[model samples]
Target: MAGRQTRGRQRIPIQFIESQDDMYATFSKRRLGLYKKASELSTLCGVDIGLIIFSPTGNPYSFFSPGAEAIMERYRNPDQPVSGIPQFIDDHSRTQLVQLNQALDEVLEMKEQIKDREKQLDEADGIRPKGWWEHVPVESLNANQVLTWTTWFENVRTQIRTRKEELRNGAGTSAAPGSTR
Candidate 1:
């Protein structure tokens, strides 16, 4: 593999693997060894390297030093990219944005569930609690509790709407055609 051709004495091509089956076996072994070396380099020298691999069948694999996706994202854009400092910041910001979006989705789902639960509790107790908001302050909420409340609220709302429809229909009130609710 070291005998692979080079364009210049100083500039060596990092891609050492050939497409031949015998070469492929050597490549696989070397790739693992290379990854180990990369890990050592990052840990010892405090350098970040993003290693990407394409197998013989064209499957993809990767390793990231310290912060995984952040390192790759720093190199994702070439032409419009900044050097070093701001690049790392942008990578961190991008990672944070992804995590924020995931959390937002989870909250939205929880809200739906809370609406359902509120309705059910109202039905079961035959009363809506006065000062419910003051009783359960948002600041004291945990994620799991919020999700549970959301589920109950949504289910109860559905039940109330269904009951209201039943009452309206029984009183000979006609809903507009193709409108179930």
Candidate 2:
């Protein structure tokens, strides 16, 4: 009898697969595995399991060991006292609510931090915390005042550029060896 030889499966790296088709295939296989695990867990423990999945294509897939309605009802009313089997649903709901509240608090703190940063920026610019329109009252400024401010800023910018050019030229000339007057 001739000996039979079998090829072993190749090991792939754990990083992201670049190919879209490969990624989609992996997603499908993993989703199936997840469902299988959920089923096995529910069956072995004799407990209700609800699983909801959203695919990359935005399609939703679900599996409920007992029924969707029963799981959802328990989720909706966490505080409602239940005797047998579905108490896990209430615990999950409470956990979710606590996480949601914590997330909300974090968002509010972020908003306040942003406001503080904005106020700091305004102070750095030597401007009031109020909006530009509110502080300046553009309608109140006559054409002369506007023109004067514009001309002043333009002159200031021109002077700054001129000084920078002069300094660059002076540095270059001074740094050169054997330079005459």
Candidate 3:
């Protein structure tokens, strides 16, 4: 009775854990499993593969088939020449290109978001013009269409003046259209 164990090892549940220590331990174990699988795959297929991972604390861990330098050497362009020294410029260039592409995509997405927001703001504020000259083709415009467009411009100018007057009266604002003041 003195040396008898009360509880035997029970099966661990497979589910998400909330504890940080437990999660880190799980991550470490999985990482080892991944490295083992990668090694086995490379050996079985006689293929070169490199895997690099960064932990949450920014520590880097890498596994490469054959060796890291060997894989990296094979990755570079064979036709490229170096002046008696190994140059990693090609890898850096590729990394820079990937970063630039990601940045460009982000910028384009932001531009679209801004355009959508502007459209929504315009719609909410009732800022649409009654007519636009660009809608009619310049080469196809007849005499009557040209006259009508000119009249529309004059009406828009008048509306602009009235709006400016209202703004001036409300807040003593300046910079009215076609004004020196």
What C-alpha lDDT values do all the predictions have? 0.71, 0.73, 0.72
In the predicted model 2, the residue pairs found to clash are none
Off by over 4 Å in 3: 1-18, 78-181
State which candidate, 1 or 3, has the greater TM-score.
3
TM-score of each: 0.32, 0.38, 0.34
Candidate 2 segments whose C-alpha is farther than 4 A from its true place:
1-12, 83-181
How many residue pairs clash per model? Answer: 16, 0, 0
Residue 68, model 2: lDDT of 81
User: Quick one: ranking by lDDT, best first?
Assistant: 2, 3, 1
Ranking by TM-score: 2, 3, 1
Q: Who wins the TM-score comparison?
A: 2
lDDT of 3 by residue, 1-181 (tens): 5897745656778987788897887779889999989866865565667899886567899997656765677678556554332335435443564566579879999999999999999897686554355556778989998798789778878878887787878965656555533
Per-residue accuracy of model 2 over 10-124 as CA lDDT, tens digit each: 7778998888898888789889999889866865575668999987778899987666876787688868866555556545654664566579879999999999999998788
* Candidate 3 total steric clashes: 0
